[model samples]
Target: MSQPPPAAHHAGHVAVIGRPNVGKSTLVNALVGANVSIVSNRPQTTRHRLLGIASVPGGQLVLVDTPGLHREGGRLASSALNRVLNRAARGALEGVDAAALVVEAGRWDEEDALAYDTLRASGLPVVLVVNQVDRVADKASLLPYLQRINEGREFAALHPVSALKRTGLDALVASLLAQLPEQPPLYGEDEITDRSQRFLAGELVREQLMRQLGAELPYATTVEIESFTEEPSPKAGVMYRIGAVIWVEREGQKAIVIGKGGTRLRDIGKRARERMEQLFDAKVFLQTWVRVREGWSDDESALRSLGYGDS
Candidate 1:
């Protein structure tokens, strides 16, 4: 006799919450099999909740990548960063089937404890993901620390994985799948992320800037996709006209972004154009301009206009 059919399954959302730079973005990229969230060596790189959807055999898992949480309020940028964290904490995890609290292994400290406290208050089923195992000198040494951290919390499971090396991700994916609720897929199976090409193009430029200029430039910079137009190319056969505004805090910063003889800005534009071509699979006509937006991070109205708030 033929066996009964397997039960149909549904997709669910899973928020990857943790302090900044713990490889949360990398994990999301790995899970979704694409570069959905921008990754950089710098901290606080992700300022928004990037949603990446992964399709499993039977269900889909939506991962929400949030900015790293930290103490704030002294400076304008810090205050904005704090607001980002609060928004994620208050609503990002709600209605999700489960959450993966990512922590860097061998670097656990008081900050980790505070993150745990916040997660505990969320009242969501949590899974502890000890990321960056590759960085630890003695992997065995982490077990004792893990035990202590998990002492009081009621976590569904603990997973030690390295997002950079792509180690133990299968197990992490399996654990998340088991905890997901029964529901239909929220997005199409081919869809990987919710961000638009223009938004992603701006992010790509910002990522390159972060790598080249480091913290000195990232916090002071914002990329806005002013216009995105596609038409038949006069020379390249097909052309994507992408316009972006690079905002800086001071005239000096603007000059620096433009660089001597405009070389620096040219480099940034070239790199951004290349990445956009790859992402969109077409030729791109990229135009970038640097403008001074004094204290934009501090101005509530500016922040809201930039989609950093509920404006």
Candidate 2:
């Protein structure tokens, strides 16, 4: 007699929440096994919430990667962009089957406390994912830290993982799957994320800008896809023709992004184009320009125009 396959009925959404640089996006990307989210060391790099879908054998897990929480201050003290990003982060938690509070392996901070407070307030079954454990020099030091944090509040599970190195994720996924609701897959196995190729292309450009520029400049910069059109190629079936603007807050910032002889901006465009070609699996003609949208980060309309906080 042929037996039926084991039930893979558990499937649900998991909100990955954390403080800045705690590796929430990295974990989400690693879990989905794709570049569904962009990575950068700069705070506030993820200005929007993202959904990364993963299809396990019996079930599926939707990983919601949100902006890292931080106390508002500094040039961003205007509180407009700050509000929008935090709202995005909070929105990701709504109706999620489970939540993962990511934190550095051996450290805790005020922002981590804020994240924990938010998770506790939600009353959802949470998993404490200690990320970047690979950087923990003293391997034996993690147990006591984990024990102490676990005592702070109840968690459905505690798993130490290195999202960057892809270690211990299998166990983490199994634990997360167990906590999910008994259901079928929400997204098709072939589907990876909710974001469009155009959006990701802009993100890849923004990511390179973030990586190439010094710390302060990345904050002043935001990438906007002015136009993205597709046309049939002579050889290939299709190719993407993209025109984007890198918006900055000031004239001096614009000069910096453009660089001497426009060399820097061209380099940014070249790398971004290469990334887009790989992502779209077709030739990409990426035309990028640096423009001054003074104080766009603080302006509600400018942020909206750039696709922040909108469906």
Candidate 3:
């Protein structure tokens, strides 16, 4: 098939959607060439839609990392937070130039089917990205897997990738870029993401908390940046002083985040500060406070106060 006419320039949004643990967040970071979203093996790690802008030769690819689509049940999944997240994920598809539905290379499940159906119904240009191929033992297995995926919908293209390994990413980006029309860049070429430094700072701390606490990380726990101040340094660099609070629904959850002698909280702060420093290209002084905001996840107004992507 002949390629579409080349545009002098291009800029468009591409929404990446998948079920939890399918490596959608990892792919966003890889495509952006920077860490714009938090990633973990845990389900629901990405709780909202995030934008990671990648500058290509011809255009900027605004990649939207949508939250994982899961079966909702009980009070937790039905809570105000969950509803907002799910809506935000689906809402991201609106007005996007194209969409990428990521699935594990050798695995298919009910959630994947639901996500596929949702994307098809949206009537957008869809690309099937079979991610995590590095974990697939048999390379030949992808042929049949790709066939099965194609049977469900008419995709623009199919690409198998290992988002964690940065394999086959160039082709995937090329495929999506082909579908976008020419336009001016939406953001500066040097900008990796549209999110604020404060928002990413809070996410880094939450990532550390999730990694450190593991199973003990409360579903209702959230991190908020109260004050983010920057000042000139002697070395002709800006230094950031940030104050943040970790809000938990209960006192016990607060104890888990703070830990004994505040060791865990300190660790979380340290790691988050290091990441912030690298991202901002400056030194960081981060102060984290653990506070009990009882039932914030369940409380509509409280979730609003916590603030997250598009919510």
Candidate 4:
């Protein structure tokens, strides 16, 4: 008789949860080996649940990158941010194999403690991941605290990883793989992420906006892809017609984005166009318009339309 085939491997979901600027997006990008989620120095850069799939020789791991959790006053933007947090808190951990709680090295405080408490309350197998290890000057100083956090708690494992530097990731992946159950893959082996081309394009534009326009401007702005169309060109180039709406709060802010004599808007458009072309691998014609929608973030209907929902 012919030899039987090898047994199939199991796939699992791993939620990367933490407060803002904790390197969660960086970790997801490192694991997926692609820039599926945009990264920046600003806090709360990730506004939604970004699904990145990591496939290995034996199995696959679907990582969910969520927005940071924090307390915000009653406002449409704050409400939307809270919705993203709750979705991951309730959905990602349920029936999942494990969760990696990403924390900043040498920065443990009450907020971090609260996040750890929440993870413990969830009753899922938790792994304490001390991310940004490169930022810490004294690694030995953190060991006592890590030991304290591990004491009396049932953590599947503890890992010190520098997601940005690509340190200790192999061991972390190995630990996650060992914890995963034996079964078939949850997603296609070749699939990397679930985000659409339009969504990724919008996100890339938003990332550029954040990088160019800092501070309150990044938080106040939102990018929405209005139209995307492709046209064949034999001589000039393959043209991709793209339109986006940049939302701001005040008319003055709109003026700033538009710039003096449209210089600023021209720059923004040029940079965004370059990125879109590279992403789609075609020449892109980007058209962007800025609009002032005062208090748009507080509008429930607006929030829902932007893809924030109560779960």
Question: For candidate 1, lDDT tens digit of each residue in 1-311?
Answer: 99999777767889888887898899999999988888889887787777899998877899988877665556643666457556764467767778898998867776667677777787778889999988898878988978977887788889999998999998888788878888888999999998888788889888878877775674757888889988997667788899989998899999878889999899999988998888777899899999988888767678777767430
Off by over 4 Å in 3: 1-7, 309-311
Candidate ranking (lDDT, best to worst): 2, 3, 1, 4
User: Which 10-residue span in candidate 2 carries the lowest summed lDDT?
Assistant: 211-220
Q: Any runs in candidate 4 off by more than 4 Å, and if so which?
A: 1-8, 72-90, 216-218, 233-239
**What range of 10 consecutive residues in model 4 has the weakest lDDT sum?**
72-81
Clashing residue pairs for model 4 = 9-183, 10-183, 76-297, 76-298
Model 3, residue 52: C-alpha shift (Å): 0.8
Rank candidates by TM-score, best first.
2, 3, 1, 4
The weakest ten consecutive residues by lDDT in model 1 span: 76-85
Q: Candidate 2 versus the native: TM-score?
A: 0.96
Deviation (Å) of 252 in candidate 3? 1.2
TM-score to true structure, per model: 0.93, 0.96, 0.94, 0.88
Q: Scored by CA lDDT, what does every candidate get?
A: 0.82, 0.87, 0.87, 0.78
